[model samples]
Structures are given as C-alpha cells and as structure tokens.
Target chain A: MSVSGAVSEIVAERWVERTLAAYPAEILPFLSGEHDRFRNPVGQVIQESLTTLARELLGAMDNRATAPAIDALVRMRAVQDFSPSAALRFIFDLRPVIAEVCGEVTPQLESRIDELALMAFDRYLACREQIASLREKELRVRALSPAR
Target chain B: MPETLVQIEQKAPRGDWRDPHVEFRKGSICYSAAAKNLGALSLPNPRAWQPMDADWKLPPDWKRIVLDGMKERLKKYRSFRLFMDICVRCGACADKCHFYLGSADPKNMPVVRAELMRSIYRRYFTLTGRLFGSLAGGRELTEDVIKEWFYYFYQCTECRRCSVFCPYGIDTAEITMMGRELLNLIGCNTNWVLEPAANCFRTGNHLGIQPHGFKDSIDFAAEEASEITGLDIEVPINRKGAEVLFVMPSADYFGTPHYYTLLGYLMLFREIGLDYTVSAYASEGGNFGLFSSHEMMKRLNAKIYDEARRLRVKWILGGECGHMWRVLHQYMDTMNGPADFLEVPVSPITGTVFENARSTRAVHICEFTADLIHHGTLKLDPRRNDHWIATYHDSCNPARAMGLLEEPRTILKSVCRNFHEMPENTIREQTFCCGSGAGLGTDENLEMRLRGGFPRANAVKYVKEKHGVNLLTCICAIDKATLPTLLEYWVPGVEVAGVHELLGNALVMTGEKERVADLRGELFAPEAHSVGSASEASHA
Candidate 1:
C-alpha cells in the first residue's frame, strides 16, 4: 500500500472513533450501534460524513464532497443543546487524533485540518442564520394579516 | 492502527433519572402562561412566571392541589388511570419516541416520560407506594418534580407513536394530556397554549381574530383563489341558512403554506357548488385547549356545534388539522355531544354518508374529497402537479387517534403522478410528529423542536435521496405550519404543503383562466422541477 493510502485509512477510522466519543454518553449507544441509516440517522449521518471527511482530509480535500459532509453533521449539532465550543470541538479534536495515530503531526495534514475547521465554522454560522430566519418567517406567518 | 482509537470511553456513567433535577435551558423549554390569558379563562393561580425562574409562583398549597387534581382525574378518566397503572417497563417504548430517537435523552423515552407521572401516582394513589415509598418505585411529590413534569410533558407532542408498539396498548398522549391538565390546576402552563385558548374562548378563534378580521382573511384567500383559478368565488360566512358549516384552524387562514391550503379549499368548494358556510365565530377547529385541559377543550369545541346549530346546518365539515380532528373524532361527541340538533353528515355532491362521524356530525375534508374522487365528480388533471414528486406525512392525531390513513394517500395518488412513500417505519399509523404539535410550536423552543423533529426529517431525507421527492403533503394544520421550518433545517430541498394545495393545483376548474403557475405562484413547467433539482428550488 502507498504511505498516503495507509495514512488515510488509519486517520479516517481514528477521526470517526474520536467524533463518536464527543457525543453525550446517553447517546453513545445510538450513535455507535449497528448502522441503519433509517433507524439511526444521527449516527448514520455522523459516520457517513466523517468517513467522507477523513478521506477528503487525507487526499484531495475536495470542497464538493467535504462541504456537504461538514454541513450535514454540523447542522445536526448546531440545533442540539451544545455550546459553540462543545459543538465544534469534534472538528478541532481531529488534530490530536491524527497526531496520536501517526506519532507525528505533518504540516500538510495540520493545514488541511485547519481548513476543515474553517469550513465547519462557516456551516455552523449558516445553520444558525437559517434557524433565526425560519423563526422570523414563522412569526410572520402566525399573524392575522397576510404580508401580501 | 490500535484496536481502539484515542482512549475510547465506551460506557458513560448513567445518572438516576428519578432525581427530579431538571436544568432549564433557554431553547428547550417555553415561557410560562401569561396572567391575562389564565384570568381570561378564569383558570386558577394566574400569575406571571418563567420556567427558568426559581419561583414558578404556584399556588400556596400547590402540592395538595396537584394531588387533589390527580385524584379527581383518576376517578374520572379510566384511560388516564389505566395508562398510569399498566406499564410493564419492558423498554419496548424506550426508543419509539421521536424526541428520544433524535436527542438520545433517556427521559424522552416513552416509558420514562410516562414514568415521570407514573412514579408520583405510585407514591400517593397506590397502596404499595403509600406503604413502601421508595421501595415501591415511588418518589415524594416535591416542587422539583412539578418542574420536571412541566419540562417533560411539554417536550412530548402527544404523538402516541409508542402506544402503537406497546403490547398493552397504553395511550401515552392521554397521559400527557392529563399531566398538562394537572399542571393547569396550579397555573403551570405555556403562553403558546393558554394565550391561543384564551383568545379562542373570547373572540371565537385562537388568533383572537374578530368577525371582521376573520372575514377579511377569508376574503383575501378567496380573492387569491379566484385570481389563480379565474373563477369568481364567493364565500358565505355566518350565513344562517347554509347546508353545512365549515370550520378550519385559524392558522389555515393566517399562516403560509396553510393559506395555500385555504385557497385549495375555496376552489374545491366553488367548483363543486356545495352550499357551505364558513363560521368566523367558531373559526378555529384546532383546540389549543386540548393542550391545556379537557374542560378547556370542551369549552373551545362547543362553539363548532353551537355555530352549526345557529346556522341550521345539517352537519360540520372540518378542515385539515391534526389535534382538531383528535378532539372532533375522539372527544367532541363525548365532551359536548348529543348534537341531536344536527343531522348526520352526507356530502351534497357525492351523496356518500359519513356514518363514522354520524354521531359527532363532523366530517373530515379528506374523507369528503376522497369520496368526491371515488364518485368521479371533479375533473382533475394530474399533470398540472407534474412539478411535484410528493410524499405523505400522516400527522400523529389523524393516524394514531382517528385511523385516517388511506384517504390522504388516495387523494395524493389521484392528484400527482410522481408520488413516493417514506420508510415503512415512518409513515401511515407509525408516522412521526412535526415535533411542534400540541402548542409546542413556538419561537423560543426552536432548538428542542429541531431535535424532536429530527427523526421525521431523517425519514424525509431518505425519500429525497432515493426518489428526489420535493413536496411533503400532510393533513394537519400544525404540520403545515411547522414541517416547512423543520425541513428547512434538516432536509433543505423538501417543501411542505397541505394535501389540498396539490388538489387545488391539479383541479381543472370550470370557466377558469389558463393556468401558468401552481397555487403558490410557482410555474407548472415540468422543466423547472426536474428530479434532483429540488435542492435549488426556493419556496416562499
């Protein structure tokens, strides 16, 4: 196997594993249970997105794949009862997981992880904006007179 | 790679759920009921309070009043008593709740949510509990327990998805209703529920729209429908000599997506030439009182029958709504019944007898429309709705409470060519809630609503991925109001519409102008709605 291919597999598995750890313990069983997409969507989304993210982080770092994956996972977290740090900690936590698995932090991987974090931050803000906008829309609709 | 990654902690310590220590977060809970609303209803212990405040300013003897209320209700309601008594705690219902499925909060599990009340019942009402106390799985009633009750009971949308899976057939929604009623005695209620109910009792509708305001809203919708259909549609409101009285949730007129459904109703009524009159006095069919208490539900629901009597109508026809149908189907006849003044509901156009609603004298609009289609009364061009690849969401009350499963699907099949069903576990009798039903749909509680709605949205995402489904048609007014926001958050591409909106789009109205756009003013061009292109289509 190529050195990068081996690194991607190891890093991807570690990333998914550490990310699952970040959820509350009560939810851990559901998140780590047998992967049925319909039955366990939160877990399924997290796993699928993280797997794609790990691959992208290690390889091409394609925005097309990475942005949606980041969006899917972060939107779920954004609406959950987590503070800003706690919600985004999983992204930042990836740095240490990669280092621990590889025994040394490569500058290239470090830069890629930083870039992924910025993408997640952007997604987090967008999700919050959508939520606030939705709230405003609901209030407008709940009124007696139509805006039109 | 190591066997495990990064010192994994497999088991997180589980805390005692019976501790009754609830942390009131900002978005998880709703604001307390306003004093003016409670006083408007002449309800007990009306005072301004917040869930986050240390003092709820409950009655001086709140415990005594609560226990007394529970005692009286247990004596009166056998369903509530049976639900409290018969739980085997088999955990069959633990994961069935959407909130539990989404949030993974243990207390949200159906068994535990019911147990929040059951444990207290075991302590005071049952023999084993009074004797053995903690040993009998009972805890003393404290102020903290009341807070926990307020927090968790409102968290439940009264969906009853769990009751479907239970071996003993426990109706958990009734238990929630009872819990809220008990809370109401101590004036522990949410403004979202009480304010609307107070408005409903006073001005005849939840939004407190006076007769003129209600007429203006309906006139606006009728004008919009006329413009869309090119037919001059005239609606009769509070006409004393109408054949049938139509009652809709106020949101159907006031809310978006819901307003589209109203336009659909107007077009259908006009096309069929049915002699129906809309009642502005009994304007709202959805009883927020159902969320408050049985008595309040009865008070708010009495207006429908009263208006039917005043108008000398044969029967009542209810518009698309969830809890409204629940109140109409399960409780209305019992609560305010012997509508002996009204005749059984039979469709003037189809001549089909609604025998199921004969006693209640209130027919669902879906049942009526489905009958019309069955009889080949209205001309429908399904290609008009070619823009939508649709799926049906069976609103909780209609599915579990009333068994209104097939009528909506039958209507969708007739109106739209591209139709798909969500996963078997998530549709038709086993369907999940919009998570904001039963007065939980409020701005302050958006986070919990999002989490609670996750399961339903997840299922929608499955269909969106598999079939490129763009439209979710439901029969509930609350579903119409809340599911749009829920989809916007989780599954962005899928838009929410009432079943009638699609019907309106597809209905080939007589003497109607040539149509260029669907009911929401979107183009009917199939090219604009290619499969998998819904992600880019923005809905107003």
Candidate 2:
C-alpha cells in the first residue's frame, strides 16, 4: 500500500489529467492544463516530501500515517485559503485518476488504495473543520477587542 | 434664484400643527411622535407626501451604469470576489438578526436581506445566472424591486453582528453598501437621507443650520453646562490650529438630552484644559442614513477630512453616535485616506496612546473619558450617580461592530456607584439597536421603527421590571434621541442618558459647592438626599 517515488509521480500526473477532464466543455478552454506552470513541479516535490515526512512522523501504523499525511495536506490547502468544499473537490478529482493509474495492480491492492483515499479524505475534512473553527474564533476575538 | 426659492418656500407648508403635543415633542425634544403610536401615526401633513412622478423612471441602461461603477471600485480586490461568490444559503443568520428577531418577518432574514444585492450580482456577473435566469434565482431589476431594496437595505443598521454567526463569513454590511451604491446610480434615494447628504456636501453639516445657528446652539449648550457646573465652559468653534477637533452629529447640536451630552463634552474638555475646537462646517460625525448608500455616505463624510484640514486639527474626537462610529471605524480610512496630518490621539491627561485607532487618529468620547479617569485627572464623586439603578446599552457601533465594548463600561463603573448590565446576549456584540438607528429613527417610518426598536426596548423593559433599573445609559447621540422615544412607547417610564451625562453629574471640580443646589436637584430627589438627621428630616 506504500506509494514509492515513481508511484507518487504516476498518481499526481493522473490526478492532474482527471481534474482537467471534469470541467464542462464550455470551461475546458479556461483550464490552465497545469495547476500553475511554475508551482506544479515544485508543488509535487513538496507534496511527496511531506508524504514521506508524514510516514516518518507517524512511525508505526500505516493507518495512522494516512491521517497525518491528510492533516498536512489540509493544512497546506488552508494556507492557500482553500475551503473544505474546495478541498473535497480536489480529492474527488483525484479518484478517477487513481483508478486509471492503479487499475493494472492486484484487486486487493486496488481496494487497499481506495480505503486509504477514503480515510485520507475524512482526515482532511476533520482538519479543515478544525481550521475553520479556529478562524471563526480568531475573528470573534478580533471583533470583540477594543481596537477592531 | 431668489424668486424660485421664495416660490418653493411658499409651496412648502408652514409648520402644520396636527397635534400640539406631537408638535412640542418633535420641535423641542426631536422625539418622533410616530414612535409613540407605532401602528396608527400619520404623516404630519398628508398633502405634503406625494408618490414619485410617473415620468420618474431609471435610465434604460441603469444596470450597465451601476455594474461598470462597481467593477471599477472592486477591480483591485480578489477577496471581495470570493466573498461575493461563496454563500451557501444556510439560515443561521436569519434568527440572529435584531430586526428579524423583532419583526418576525421572512424577508428580514439575513440571507434574503443579502440576496437583494446577491441576486443582482449573479444576474449580471455570473455565468450560471446568464445561462439559467430565474431558475438560478436571478431576477430582472425593476422599480418595485428597487423600492423593496431601499426599504429593507435601509432597515439594516449595518451593525455587522450577523457576520459573527455567518457560516461563510458573509458580511451583510458589505452587501448593504453595494445595495446603496446601486440605488444611488438610479436616483431612487430618500429625501431625508439624500437632502441631508446634499446639505452636508454644500454646507459641511447635515442640518444646513448655518454658522450663526451653530454658534447659537453651542452657546446655548455651554450656558446649560455652566448652569450645571459652576464653570463658564466655552465651546470654541472653527478656531484654526486647535489641538483637537470635536466632530459630532448635527442631532447633538439641536436634539435635547443629546445636547446635554454635548455640554458634558464641553465641560470635560474645559475642566481638563484641552485645546479643542468644534467645526462650524463639519458639525456632524454620524450619518445614520448613509446605511442606505455609499455615494450619500461619501458626500456626507467628504466634509470631515476637509474640515479637519481647514481647522488644522491634529486629532478628531467623534461624538457618541452609533452609525457614525461604524462608518468612521470601518470605512473612513479606506474611503478618505492618507490623512498624514493627523496622529493617533494620546490622551492629554493620561499620556496613554489609543492603540486601536484607525483612519485619521480618531478617538471615541468614552475612550477619552476612560483614559482621563485612568490618569486620575478627572475629579470624581461616584456617589452622585447612586440614586438610580443604571445599566449601559452598548450602542451597536461601539460594541459588536467596532469592539469598543470595554472602554465605555470602564468609565461607567468608575463614575457610577451602581452600574449593572442587561442580560448577557443584550450587551457587548450581541446588543440590540435603539430601534431608531440607521435613519429608521425618523417619524416617517412608524411600523418599521416599532419592529426594529422592539428587541432593544424589550431588553431594557426586562431589566427595569426585574431589577428596578430606571435609567439606561449609552454613549451614542442617536441612542439618546431614539431610545427615549422607544422607551416612551414600550417601557413607558425608563429614562436614557449618555454615559458622559452621568460623568458630568459625578464630576467634582473647583466651585462645586456653588453648584450643589443645581446638582442636588438634577442628580437626587429631595427625599433621596436629605442633609438633616432622620428625626430632623421627619420633622421638616
């Protein structure tokens, strides 16, 4: 179930392809083809680096490693001002890509990967909700302070 | 020109007196009699009220004009675009609205309130709306819808309390501003709001009460202040190079009870020996009616920066008014900027800097007083305010909107011996409007006034019935004018006064002995503050 370096690039490239495919025909012309020309390669490198960091950070259980990786991913999206709904869209877009790229693997491996994706999405959602709550609290404190 | 002016004056009715008591209330106290008889109050002269002319239609291309203007204003901001785009229509903000809570009306729902502008935004700007039309909840703009927009948009106090609970962080105040901007593009503005804005544009004050009237009002207030405190307080006006410019709403200049708070400011400034001057030109700081439109708001506020420059004041002290403070705190800096001549005000008495200041180094009157009290420069006899159970109504501007909740309370607690807060939800950011704020405080809108004022009046009534609270204290000038009218309608016996009025009553200064008779009469009843022993008092 571990995504090696070659497997990570294969997964990311499939994600980008699937995301570009989901747009309606009218919006196809507006799609950037790449997320951002300058950021895409660097972003993929950082995302993979963080996945390794999450594995090292979590140390023992593979299920536990999945949660930390998803948490880190959610934190990254929040720093970019991505809402939970938008985060969900990004995850959903990656699904068809995962199926297409990982289809030739064993059925058992495919089910394990699907389970990991679902678990990661749930953890990402929980992190997004936590971030949103913190943001709301911060806003309240700023509003209640004398010097708003 | 003179002939036309004379003709217009002749056509305008000369003070129609329907009921002398009503006339007395409006003319002297500025208490809108409409607030008293909420459901049945009639216009002062029905003849004077006319529907818009049949030919008065918006230009055929009004939408293009408004959208172009909005695009130009919003071109630089990506966040504003996102804010406009991301509303999920969950009804959390509906019950949280003070107006909706009071009125129980479906249209007053915050989502619907915001949708007045949002629908228009979608219709004109979004691809979904351009494709789907009414199915996408986009409707064509018509005169009727515009009128409804005006009615509900003006109903909002722009208090921003609803934004606190909004799941999307959607600020209804921003939507209200956009609504006002669009309304202004078509010239469908109220005479009360537009005329005052026009007056402020031309004469630097909303009332258009000329320099002589300004002087007269100030001198009269100073005389009253002198009568209360034995000091001959002089309220200097338009004096160049003054250290501070005291800008207040025009209502404070002419409105009763509000005039008392103005006098309190005068006495405190004189007592502390601060170099300040009132601007004869820019007399009003609050534009409650500007809740309707940004153009009207900008027109009214245009004088503030210019007047400060003309007077060469180092700092401006905003009077205790609700919406005015909201406008000043929220948009003054953004709308009128680079006021490099001004510095954030350091209290002359305390030497403490006001850290929460925005745009042109303005300070609220209560913040100024709290600082003065902190410095120990303001002589206090807190016992003077002990006769009545006092509760503070945190005006919406200073509370949830601007976060100026504590400074006023600090001053009140220090000055008043017995100070209490109303229920928890009824104070600080959750505080209710005095029903008459955001220009609905006028006599013309009786039903709307009752709906808006009900929550605030009910809260004050609850405290009064339960705790024997007789007086409601707030810092805003509009609160003084409007709360009294509302209390008369709902609570019947409760009195509302400015926080500074209580401070003035408690102030102990040089020649305090000579003013004891006047102070005792106003501050305490004969039975409450008898000087003689109990047996001697009984005999007397």
Candidate 3:
C-alpha cells in the first residue's frame, strides 16, 4: 500500500486511539452518544481530511472542491485558542505518521506534506477572514444600534 | 524515516471556565435583535444594540428596573426560585446541554448558564449571598451581568432537557425566561423573535402576510397539492361551524420542504373527509412570541381560542411544529385556556380519543394520524417511499416538554419502509435544538447558529455516513425551515422533510391516477419505473 493511504488509515484508526487519550475521563465517556461522533467530530473531520490529502498526493484528486470542507475545520481551529503553529501542525503530523508506517518513503512524502500545510494555512486565513468580517459586522451593528 | 507522530493533548492547561481576555468573542456569540422589529412588537424598553458592545444604552435606573423585574418574576414562578436554590452543582446536566457539548465552553453547561442568573438571584435575594457576595457564588447585578444574561439567555432555546435530568426538576428554561424578562426591562432582546411576534400580533401570521395574502398563499399551495394528489382539495379558511380549526407555521405556506408538509395536511384531511377550516385570523400554529416574554406569548396564543370560538370548531387540529405544540400542550391551557367551549378531540376517522390533550383539546396531527394508521383507516403505501431512507429528528420542545415522541415515529413506521433513528441521546427528550430555534433563526446570526447547530449536524453526518439516510424528517416547522441549512452545511446532500411530507408520498389516496413522481417532482422509486410501465398498461 502507498504510504499516504497507510498514513490515512493510521490517522483514522491508529492515531485516533492515542488522540482519544488526550481528553479527560470526564469527556471520554461521551464518545458513545447517539450521534456517532458525539465527543470527537473534529477527529472525524481530521480523519476525513486524510483520504483527500492522500488522494491529492497520489495525483488522483485536487482539493479545490474539498478546500471548503477542510477550511471549515481549520476555521474552527483558528478562532479557537490554538496558536498558528499548533493549529496548522496537524497537517505536518502525517509526515512522521507515514514515516513510522512505511519508513522507506518518509523523504518522498515531504513535498506532499509541504503542499498540504500551505493549503491548510491558506484555508485557515480565509476562515479567519470570514470570522473577522463577522466581527466587523457585529461592530457596525453596534455603531448603528438605536440610541437612548 | 522521521520519528513517529505524537498525540496532541486535548485538555487545556488549567481547565478554566471563564477566559476574561476573550469574553466578548466574535464567533461564539449571537447578534442583537434589530430596533425596528422590537418597536413593531411594542416590547418594553425597545432599542437595537449588540451584546459585544460596552454601552447597551440602558435607562438611568436600569439596575432598579432589572432588580424589580427579577423580584416580580421570582414571586410569580416558583420554578425560578427552585432552580436557583436546588442545584447542588453535581454536573449531570453539564454534558446534557447541546451548546456545551458542541462548543466545549464550560459556561455553556446547563448548570453554569443557569448559575449566571442564579448568582444574581443569590446576591439580591438570599441572606448568605448578601453577606458573603462572591464567596457564596453571588454576583452583583452589574451591567456586565446584564450583558451576560442577554448573551446566555438568547443562547438557550429553553428546550428544558436540563430540567429533565435535574433531580429537583429545576428547569433552566425558567431561569432563562426570568433572565430574558429582566433583560427586556433593560431593552435587551433579539429582533428575530420580536419581529415575528409583532408581525403575528398585527397581521395574524409571523410573516406579516395580510388576510388576502394568507389566503392566496394557501390557495397556491392547494393548487400544488392538486398537482401531486390529482384531486382538487379545497382548504377551508375562516368558515364557521367546522369541526376542526387547523393551523401550522406560515413557513409551510411559503417555503419548500414545509410546503410539502402543508400538502400532506391537505391530502390527509381530504382522505378522512374531516370538516376542518384553516384560519387567516389565527393562521400560525408556531408562536414566535413563545421565545419572547410570557405576556407576549399569551397575547399571541389568545388568537387560537378566539378564532376557534369565532369559527365554532369542535377542537383544534395542530399541524407539524415544535414550540407551537410546546405552547399548545404546556402553556396554552394555563395561559388562555379552559378550552371548555370546544369538544375533546376524537379523530373523526379512527374515533380514538386523545386523553393526554384532554384539557387543551388540541391534538397534534401526528397523534391524530398515528391512531388512524393503528386502526387501519388510511391506506398508506410504504413502497412509494423507497427512494428515501428516512431518519427522525425530534424537535426539542415537543419531545422534552410534552413527550409527543411516539406518535410521529409510529406514523413514520407505518408510512415509510426504511426508518433509522439518530443516536439515543440525540433523539426524543434528549434531542438537540435546530440551532436557530427560540428566535435565533435569522441570517445575520448564521455563524452562531452554525456553531450552535454543530452537535445536531454532526449527528446527521454520522447517520448519512453509516445508514445512507438521505431524508431528515422532523415534526417542527422551524426544523423544516432551519435544519435544511444546518444539514446542507454539515452533512451536505441529506435533504430534510416533515413527517407528514413523507406520509404524503406514501398515502394511498382514493381514486388517484397512475402515480410516477413523488412530491418535489422526484420519481416514485428508482426501480419502480420498469413495473410502473406494466401497471400503466393494466390501468389503461
């Protein structure tokens, strides 16, 4: 199997196992809510990105259509407390994941990693711009608010 | 090979509740209701302003006004005092809240959201709180506290799921209502709610359609229903001596998805041959005034009884709606009731008595139909719904407040072949809000609605991925209008429909022509086309 597909699987299944440990025991129990992704919609979203990222790397797909979906996740991260490096850091995590899964092709996946990071960063900024516009709108409404 | 990827820690360093630095967040907060809308509704202290602003333009004595408002409401609603005093902070209600579960903001927890108001209640009302202040969790009724009340109170849809799990039955809805009542004294309210309430009060419908306009819209829908059902159905409007006075959300008359549900109502009424009249005077079943203060809600609710009395109907047959039924079942009886003038609603077709709604004498259309289905009165063709693998979204108010859960599902199972449920926690009693509910369903507040809707949307996404369920059928008119946008964003391609809309597709109407296309002009079934050709020949 290609390293990207292997990386995708590990992220969806393998990495998710470890990431689940990141939350507290208080939050861990809610992973079973009826909506399948109750406590971990982001993990599903992150897992969702792997296939498209993997597909894009193999020259079988373009992220143009997929960018909005990816950007949605990035937008959440950007507005959240995650620092810029930390927010975009997940894209780069796939590189080492691939290396561990298929050690022979770690260097081969570098360009793909770089490309995905750039796209993610661009998407994050776009989301940030949307949030900024909303914030601006809120301000405008405040300014135009009915006076006493 | 590079070293292995490490798992990112999910927990924050301190696990703090309040982040004072970003308290006025752009993404997480809701926008204020506009001035013109509030003015039209004739709300007290009406003025437009954003919650994020430092200056809310309160009156000179806003503090006294709010404190008095709280004192008045506390005396009126024992639930308010009970909610304030009973909470032991056990946090069973923490994860139960959809807002907290979606946003991970600790303040979104039901206990904390209620605590915002409870804190003020403690400071002003309790002796220990008056003495100890912040030490006893009593916060002064500062302008910031008012701002917080406006922010969080609007954030709540008042679904009362928090009260369901509370041991003392301390309803957060009571707290939120008291918070909003206090906010109203300070001229803080959302425009989306007030405008609709104002419009409904003025024009007899929330959309502000005049009598002729309301009639024209229903007639246009009746014409559309004629196309689907191949029968000329005359929907009675404002005719006296009708056995039933039918009402639904005005959205059903004007919009897609909802309009189909409107068609469902028409076809079902025709098949049963029930004598029912739709009222242009009391045209709306869904009350936006429910989201506003109780006085406004009572004013809006008075019309149903008035119209029902004027028209001299036997009982009210309510259409598919969420908060509408919450008002009809829970509040309407107490507010403007003793509906003694009307007879207890027994289904004309099945002859089943609705004992649960005996006092209000209002029966949900689903409960009416579920009896018909159970009694083998209506011929429902389940094969007509082969195109849709449906899932039920229990709109919050009906499920939690009234327990009107089984009737809709019973009808769905009888009418549709493929039915799957959302996760147990997300359906019936534990159902999440449509995000835009409780008067938050406006375009300007789309971002907050989207954020608020994430948990519900996430659940739909899972069912789409696993069950290949394409249709998200609900019983709420607000759900019909808002859930489409929510689903389109989070789980694209999963279309929403009403429970009646599905029943419309599956209803075996008397003496109907050869059916090929379902409502929305889609094919009856993908595979049925081959067999349909043979049936066409046989019918000819």
Model 3 TM-score relative to the real fold = 0.84
Q: How well is each residue in A1-148 modelled by candidate 2, as lDDT tens digits?
A: 5555556566665554443333223223323332331112213323443445323322342655555555544443432213345544545444455557655555555455566557657766664465355435434532442212
Better of 2 and 3 by lDDT: 3
TM-score, candidate number 1: 0.92
For candidate 1, list the clashing residue pairs, or say none.
none
- Considering only N, C-alpha and C atoms within 3 Å, which residue pairs clash in candidate 3? A34-B423, B33-B190, B33-B191
Model 3: per-residue Cα lDDT over B83-122, one tens digit each: 7788999877877676666555557678988888788888
Docking tier of model 2: it is: incorrect
lDDT of 2 at B252: 75
Ranking by TM-score: 1, 3, 2
- Residue-level error in angstroms, candidate 2, position B11: 45
lDDT tens string, model 1, B1-540?
787544444333357889898889987788898899989999999887799999988878999999999999999988888888889998778778888877767888889989999999999999999999989999999999999999999999998899898999998888899999999999999999998898889888877889898999899998999888778998999999899999998889988788889999999999899899998898998999899999999999998998899899988899998999889888987899978899888899878889998789999999999999888887777777888899999999988889999999888999888999999989988898889998999878988999999989999988999999999999998898789889988888999999999988877777777776888998886653332232332211
- Candidate 1, residue B151: how far the Cα is off, in Å: 0.9
Model 3 CA deviation exceeding 4 Å by range: A1-36, A39-112, A122-148, B1-28, B526-540
Residue B49 lDDT, candidate 1, scale 0-100: 78
After superposing candidate 1, which stretches have Cα over 4 Å from the reference?
A1-17, A22-26, A142-148, B1-14, B526-540
Give candidate 1's error at residue B380 in angstroms.
0.7
How far is B326's C-alpha from truth in model 3 (Å)?
1.1
Could you arrange the candidates by DockQ from highest to lowest?
A: 1, 3, 2
How well is each residue in B1-540 modelled by candidate 2, as lDDT tens digits? Answer: 677533321111222111111111111011111211111111111122112333335567766777786676466445456667888977667656666655434456677777766676677678888899767877665555665676667677676767877878887777776776666565544444544555555556666677887898889888878777667788888899998888887777776667667766777787788899998888878773465455556656767878888888888888888777777777677777657778777876778887777455888888888878776776666655667688999888778767888888878887676777887776787777776666555554443555466667767767887888888999887788667756765576788888887776666665534343323246353433432122211110
Per-candidate TM-scores read: 0.92, 0.67, 0.84
